[model samples]
Target: MKNTSAVILFAAMLASLVSCKTGGKALLPNVSGKAGEVAVVIDKENWEGSLGTEVKGLLARDCEYLPQREPLYSLVNVSPSAFADLFKYHRNIVMFNIAPDVEKQEIVYRTDVWAKTQCLIQINASCADSASVLLERNGENIAEAIEQAERNRVIINTLQYEETKLGDEIAKMIGGRIHIPVGYNFKKVTDNFIWIADEKQYSTQGIFVYRCPAEDEDPFTLEKIVARRNEVLKNNVPGMFENTYMTTSEYVVPGVRFLKYKGRDFVETRGLWEVKNDFMGGPFVSHSFYSKDGKEIIVLEAWVYAAKFDKRQFMRQTESFLYSFEWDKE
Candidate 1:
């Protein structure tokens, strides 16, 4: 009897240990340096088109432009939205490289832009020993050179800002502020998640909005989007819910059904879905929306699972989010 009791205790302890372990660790690919390189290529292409002759003229007037390997200004068409997408979705910095030569692999300029709009610049002359030596030996005024490069970046960013502001204004015209039903507050959580609620309002209606500018593709149509949402609901958690399409005067939205919670409506609408799978189990949501004017799309999405919590409580939370939904008026 003593031996049997000891054995049982050991088994219980082992089971407890196993239960405590958390699963779902993900190994993401390293794409850190790619954005900056991409940005440089884009900038070169754009400058080449817009002011290639003029810039070459300027370089000839100020700095030496060698036919063999000269540093000529050019611009590459980079989707502003794509740059934003990199920052918003990947949480990676978009860097610009202005290396003098392709073979050198030395970066002349490096800047990290958040949401493809905010910029942080870093330049190093040591990457290229030849260039560094030449600059140092000649005493070619490093401070002035660095200042000029930074000034160029400022000009680029200023142009980008003007474009973004215009886009925002257009978006506001399309989707006038929907107004978060009275009595709710926006609560921002760590790592970009937000909770929408009011003290008294119950019902799972909160919405989460994420900006992914790198996704420059056209927004998915209502039909295609609804289908994708249904696919997620069907495959991720089986037999617990059904998905259907809800049509409004302006748009068709996707909704999920809860078998556990009868007579509750769970609908979600967005212009784009920026899904991240390994973050909170699977298929975390990110969405964008455009105004009726068709200038900009506002995106709202959420990740809380109603299946994990009590049906009534989940419904209440959902309602609170939905009721609190609002859009910028201007």
Candidate 2:
């Protein structure tokens, strides 16, 4: 594998130079491999040891808020000498380099190194133990980098195929920016609540936008948020059956996370929603924050229902639309 990769590298570099001469522009090939996959570049010996265990635990942990157990990332081992050509262009990669002369261990995060929008995390250490320590200390930060990169691609695609008329209404209503991708239409629109959905033969993807007076002193508490969500859905969202309304599922406890993105702070809540007196359920994620005027709390929620298929990527694709939050107040 090593020898073959080296030969492929020589040919790839030559092709790159030739492409540059043709248009006076160096166009990189689009990123390869499936989403949620990471290529771990290490030597055979080190990959079988404790350091590899730590790397897998960080990157391969199960994604949260899903109905079934699915790893956050599927890892493919690419030994040091075999990391060339095609494998070098994977969407996500974590590479380890240990040298005798290296005095300190450092973890570096890089993007678009060999492919556009690709995320590469490199760990430089003097030995395997040093690498393990670094991974333990910066695991969350590293995992977040990969996660952001994956979502960024989705957001980029969503921008190209947005729903303009719907965006205009959403902007006028909330005085802010959020992308509503194609294939969605307003299912219900009211003064304080809006429901948009894309219902298909085998799946259902929906988004809910809500605005309410910031009356509660502690508005972001778990109890307050869940209660508000249940109330809103109960009044607005209903099932196909008579007397059925949507509500938060209590079988599994709902969760909330306070995090920041692009200098904006918001609380993210995740849980399952089921219809009252009916047999319909799926996962939902919402981002809540105070509006610009500080007079109302705005919530953006996405949910997925694909009974016969995997929900991980489906939920991921829909939830990414919420992150395109830019205050469009004029």
Candidate 3:
């Protein structure tokens, strides 16, 4: 199997280069493999030992807001020699190099080393004990790096597959640009709000964009945001029932956090949503930021309704839309 994968990898690399040259422009290969997939290159013995357990615990941590306990990432363990041409281009990778002569443990991160839209994290340590210690200390950071790599992959993939007409229309209305993949359509559009969704047989993923009046007293506070969310859903998102509409689920309290990305600060909210008087419900995430003019609060929300299967990948795929947001300077 390892030899076969290596052969396929070489063929793909050759094909990509040839195609790029023929096309008159350099085109990096699209990210290969599924979202949230990670490749770990380590010796077989170490991978099957205590270090392997630690690696799995950290990288495969359970995801939240899902019906069943699904791993945060699906890790593929490959021996050092098997990390060849094609495998080198995995979207996310962690390589462990253990040597007795090495004195200190260090982690090196690189991007696009072997292919486009890839992240490689290398951990160097002197011995097994040192490597285990380093892993224990930096487990969280490593996991985050892997996760961020996938997020970046999503952004790049979205841009590559964007629907220009839909993107332009949304940009004009929202005063900014977002990568709306071709399959997504404008479900509802109003002066102050937009609802875009990718409807599938078993699930529906969506992105919601809206602006609300920005006030001095932290308009993005949890209390204020939830209040505004209910108002927006009630007005724009209607359910099948006579008096039903979408709103945050009261059964499970939502979580709020602050994060800084691409020089912008945003308040992020995560929770479940249910139709007020209907049985339909799912998970939703929103990122709120103040517009450049400071006149309104711009919030980008991504939600998923996949009742029949695990939702970790679905949520991650939709969440990438929020990160791809960029304000168009007027």
Candidate 4:
């Protein structure tokens, strides 16, 4: 009887978490579709015109730092007339409403409109031209909203099956908190650095956690961040062969941007990684930000190595765990 009661309590707690995440009183159905995919709703007229062209160009652009060309999002265009209940449950959605009756262009970004963890972006415009203008003005924001939605799904799943031991280890190692998925195993742990990876037959998803003194005269620059990673990975992360190590790719310069995400300021860097004197390579992303006391720069980074497959989703999934980071202050 006690065991059954415990199980019932756990189920209730999980349901409550889902309720909080979806912001709905009633339980919402789990979102459908694959990661890094979006369903676009538009009429056939706009589908063949410049509006669809622009939307495709924005959402389906080539993902950065991959060995092969894979779109940031695999878009499945759905005609509004054919958009049924199934399509409404997609994880990411971009819908267009173009009508003469629309007095002003309005863009409504809603979550959980039709399904849990769904990102439904409704653009109401007077015409295709006006819709295009709205998209052009807010293209970056739109993409980010979809990206966050994708990450939220990953974070939710991670929380449900989190490895509490790894979370405890991270808290001890770096004075930080992050929800880790079950498949990951601790690769290395030290005072200044920690490495964990989820290894599989087709892909390798890895993460590194470390801290710097925040003492660099001018820290948080691309040059500084890249140089630091090269130094750290070279000594710590080795390759298949002797003297081979991981380093930032010299061929492709990294890009860095300042973001205030989830109520904290951090510098996000995106670039490719290559094995020194070897052929293996893939993409990497990291977030660098100051600790609570402002004395140390806590850096959380994730990398993907999938030579046999397209790596956009792998990279996103690995890095999205970092987005679940929170301050586990003592």
Candidate of highest lDDT:
4
The positional error of residue 239 in candidate 1, measured at the CA in angstroms, is 25
TM-score of 2: 0.90
Clash pairs of candidate 3?
A: none
TM-score, cand. 1 vs. native: 0.23
lDDT of 1 by residue, 1-330 (tens): 533443344344335323332221132222333211113212344345533333234322321111122232222233323443342222122222223332443323222222222122222232234333433443233233333333333334334433233223323433322233334355443222233433332323344432222233555555545544444333332222244221111222333321111222223342212223321121223344443444533444543332233232222223233323334545
Preferred candidate (TM-score higher): 1 or 4:
4
Candidate 2 local accuracy as lDDT? 0.84
Residues 227-317 of candidate 2 have per-residue lDDT tens digits of 9999899999989989999999998898999999888889999999888998888899999999888899999999998888888888988
What's the true lDDT of residue 313 in model 4? 89
| True-vs-predicted CA distance for residue 238, candidate 3, Å | 0.9
**What's the true lDDT of residue 39 in model 3?**
90
**Which has the better lDDT: candidate 1, or candidate 2?**
2
Q: Which stretches of candidate 1 lie over 4 Å from their true place?
A: 1-206, 211-218, 222-288, 306-308, 316-320, 323-330
Task: Write the candidate numbers in order of decreasing TM-score.
Answer: 4, 2, 3, 1
Model 1, 271: alpha-carbon shift in Å?
A: 15
lDDT of each residue in 227-307, candidate 3, tens digit only: 999999999999987999999888878889999989989999998899998999888899998888788888899999898
Candidates in order, TM-scores: namely 0.23, 0.90, 0.86, 0.91
Each candidate: RMSD to true structure? 26.3, 3.9, 5.5, 9.8
lDDT of 4 by residue, 1-330 (tens): 533443344345336445566676256777788899899988777888999999999999988777688898999998765565458678898887676666779888888765778898878787889999999999999999999999999999999999989888888866777899899999998888899999999889998998878888778999999988899899889989999999999888999999998699999999999999999889999999988888888889999999888888899999999999988756
Give stretches of model 4 more than 4 Å off. 1-25
- Please tell me which model should have the higher lDDT, number 1 or number 3: 3
